[model samples]
Target chain A: MKIAVLIAPAVHPVSGRPCAGEADLAALALAQRLSSQVDVWYAGAADDAALADYLARGATHIHTLALAAGREVLSPLAEALQDYALVLCGARAGGGDGSGLLPYQLAEQLGRALLPDVLDLSKSDQQWQALQALPKGVRRTLAAKLPLVASVHARAASAVGWSYARLQQGKIQRKAATGAALPQVVLEPARRARALVAASKVSGHARMQGAIAGGEGKSAGIVVKQGDSVEKAQVVLDYLRQHQLVDF
Target chain B: MDFSTQAIPRIDPRRPWVLGPSGLKRIVLGDDSGSRDAALLAHGPAHKPLRSSGPFSQRLLVVAHAERGQLDDAAREAIAAAAILAGKDGEVLALLYGMQDAAPEALAELAVDRALTVADPGYAPEQKLALLQQLLQQESPHTVLFADRSEDADLGRRLACRARLSVVTDVVEIAADGVRRRQPGAGFSLRERAQVLLLARGVAEAKLPFVGKGERLQTAALPAISEQVQDLGSAASPASQLALEEADLIVSAGNGVSNVPGFLALAEALGAAVGASRVAVDDGRFSRDKQVGATGKTVQASAYIALGISGAVQHLQGIKSCRHVIAVNLDAAAPMIKRADLSIIDDCQSFISAFEALVRRERNLV
Candidate 1:
């Protein structure tokens, strides 16, 4: 299967230096595991310095789609990924438009099925299987036909160690743009978010109770000072059951 | 006394007495306006009742999934956002996907004017999308609200892409006119209202000041569409293999625990992820990633069991976000015991054995 790993420009969280996102690197690693004919594709604004980081990590054939200054990459990226049987990318971008909607948009544009938050990927008998990550450490296995788009989870797989040799051997080819122009985004300074607390309608006494006890009226902690190990274990079990933490 | 022409002045509650013209004391009895206050005191605040009196001129849609027939906190928040934005003239309609274990009448508490349940089984996103598009065509809601969590996150993005509308995700604050979301870098960007809104958790108060009609709308059968993706149901991964931050339950060991193998066994028995104190990691008893403290990973697990851990300030800081903490320590004076919701004063090894035995016996019985 021919796999395409979508790469996006990323910056270090603290140093703000150009770097690859952890999830995107994970996607690249997962792609390498599935097939050796994996090509790295980058679209949008230029960040060659970060692309170099992907080269250092294990990306062999890197294609940078030449998108005009302010144009969107949906149509161009979709056209670029037309040949690949599978398209894999991080569930979210590291920097630009961190809305995590690019994959969904691409899947819709290409009219392909999208398997998101994939922790692992494999292929067997002409079908792509994905281990999807759900909330609270739950996982769901999903199967889809060829020509599918999957978004790699951040915890999917760790990227291979950086190789200075790989960086020298990797090739980054610039390709012509084939996308439409998008609307200009207006940038403004971010503002502090205010928590939306409803107007209190209770009496002054009830309001005081809320203020003193804090919200959600949970009972205070229990200190079991006297009990044998068996009895204490029973207490723990009872508490766990009361909270529905454990079934048995 | 020409009482018909002149209205009598009401007595203030602060001073419930008035001096008569004859210099006699006249005591004011119960206040006529005190009935509402009495009701408030007896029944706890009365809802302001925001039933949209006028015809539905505009509609605000809230799309959510009810797990086991109960609306999660995030889903409730989305409904509240729609209700707040709908105001009096506009109607708030909720489209629920998945099996509703409870009756639709429960939506009355959420201020939902009308609810349509998509009760079809299976993981058919395409069919659900078709139904959603059909509903969208039938009632062109001004704005569709969705919770930015779990399955709704995927569904909302899919809807936005198919509709070709730019969706504002992780919207922390929403009002009738505008919405705000966190931008790429640091600050928040306030944008004009979009057609689809993916609301973040706690963006609105679920407790409403009004009651809705709670009318359950009848829906046609799901539109048949060939689905490309197949869901094979949930895969079971043992909790011990899960990451600490992602695990719902964690069993942590501290310096007081001498038996490392026993601690690991207890964690496996309890079906929980393993965590360690900084001291335990420093002693090379556990890996660096397993450390949970100020310098280690911060965990937001629902339940955390601290075995033989004397609650160090740094260790407490990491697990502070944990919903429930059970401390098993020799000393009741330990700081962990104070921070723990339930503290059992006992040796870590004995407690582990007893707990494991209890769990095994309970499982066998079941």
Candidate 2:
């Protein structure tokens, strides 16, 4: 069985700088878990080096389906997924396309079962057992036949231990697929009306000073004392309250 | 970006394919209003009972995890209201799980055609899923409506996948043939058609009448189903560090509340449970479980104090069960002020300090 894991590199919203978040790590973890049975394929919008990192972990091959400049399209990637026995993607991309609708749209187009926000998965005799999270920690398990699409949530896969030797020895080769024609949709200009207004007001000297002071206080290091249960509990509660950790 | 020339698969316009079996089965997931105090702050005084506006042409199934203590009367009323709404056109089957004991007669009074009681025997997620899937398969629902949250979304998606049907999430509006999903892009709503419609939100703005003229339904004891899985003796143990349902007084903060950390002291001072708005939860200021909104826990408490919460419709829907509401926000135009019994148009932090001091002074005088 060839399991294709979809990958979308996380990008910084403000700087457009490429990075990785918990979702990428989660995909990598899930791919590693499934590597024992099926040949894992990593298909993503990343450069050769970045793709190699995933390949080193467990992927058999790396396929890069970069979005063309001036186009916000997902057709090329969706079409390429036709060959895989089971296609898995993150529920939502971290940056630019953060709506988490890619898997849904792809499933609709392909006319296949689309499982979004899958939390648990187990395979037996070519059948897949998946657990879904419901409201209030309630979960439901489902069985699906092979050749399905799963959009993994952040909590779907558990954290896997990484090996240094695997990272060093992994060879990542990029194979490009035939790109689909870009959809003809009118692109709207990016809106920054709120940010612009906030920026202008914060540009003043006194305001900047106050912000700097606040930032410093926010980042202050925590001090812990040994064997002080009451004080420790107080610290924890205070931290949670100050940081809005609790419900209130 | 464009659907104009995408060569979208052209289904026969005259003969549209309808998925799922031909059965009048409906799955109704009920949220316990007494589970969290934030529900009272989020939903306010206008306690709109859950009711079905459209024609209910299916086997009605109601599901809820039973609450601790004497079940809140208002919460039971809400569930009863939902049951009545669901039973408007079909037989109502209720599956109440995670309860200390079975109350079948009370459920029957609430118009339950059949009641399945699962004991609070500490079933794991996988175990619960298996049982739920089995139940769903045994009684297939044409429509499934669950609370719009992470767990429900997961279950709904998985169920849809297994049933070979389309699943839409974050649906804020529901109708007969389809649902209106709040799309990602700014304020856009998508109309989706499906055989099995999973509603995250039932018909918006529809008021359901309170059940039984506020009379308490008599409890009917029933034997628990014996389904041996793994040892469930320890499963009922409390997993969360905090139990919001047991809290009488709650102090909830929102986006407008500055110094999020300061609220802890206030909670401690007033002997109140702490809660938060959806904004704070999304901002990583609090856990999603602690969030009080339409998408979060429904809280019913004696006194719900709102700090900087503006009381949006979504937030209001979650906290409508609170008896006494106190809002402290700087925004005079905030909807919370209008809904609150005592609206203080002041900084939340300052209000907290004053309230704490006043409480302290009263205690000292006593």
Candidates' lDDT values, in order?
A: 0.81, 0.52
Tens-digit lDDT string for candidate 2 (B119-200): 5434333444465566677777554444444433344444554455655555544444444554333332444544333334
What TM value does model 2 have?
0.42
Candidate 1 global Cα RMSD: 6.7
- Candidate 1 colliding pairs: B69-B101
- In model 2, which runs have C-alpha deviations exceeding 4 angstroms? A1-22, A25-248, B1-57, B66-88, B99-117, B120-140, B162-166, B183-196, B201-203, B210-366
Cα error of candidate 2 at position A150, Å:
11
All candidates: TM-score: 0.81, 0.42
Candidate 1: which stretches are off by over 4 Å? A201-205, A220-232, A238-244, B1-56, B66-72, B97-99, B103-113, B117-122, B175-177, B205-224, B253-263, B276-288, B291-295, B306-351
Task: List, residue by residue over A196-217, the lDDT tens digit for candidate 2.
Answer: 0101222243344445444322
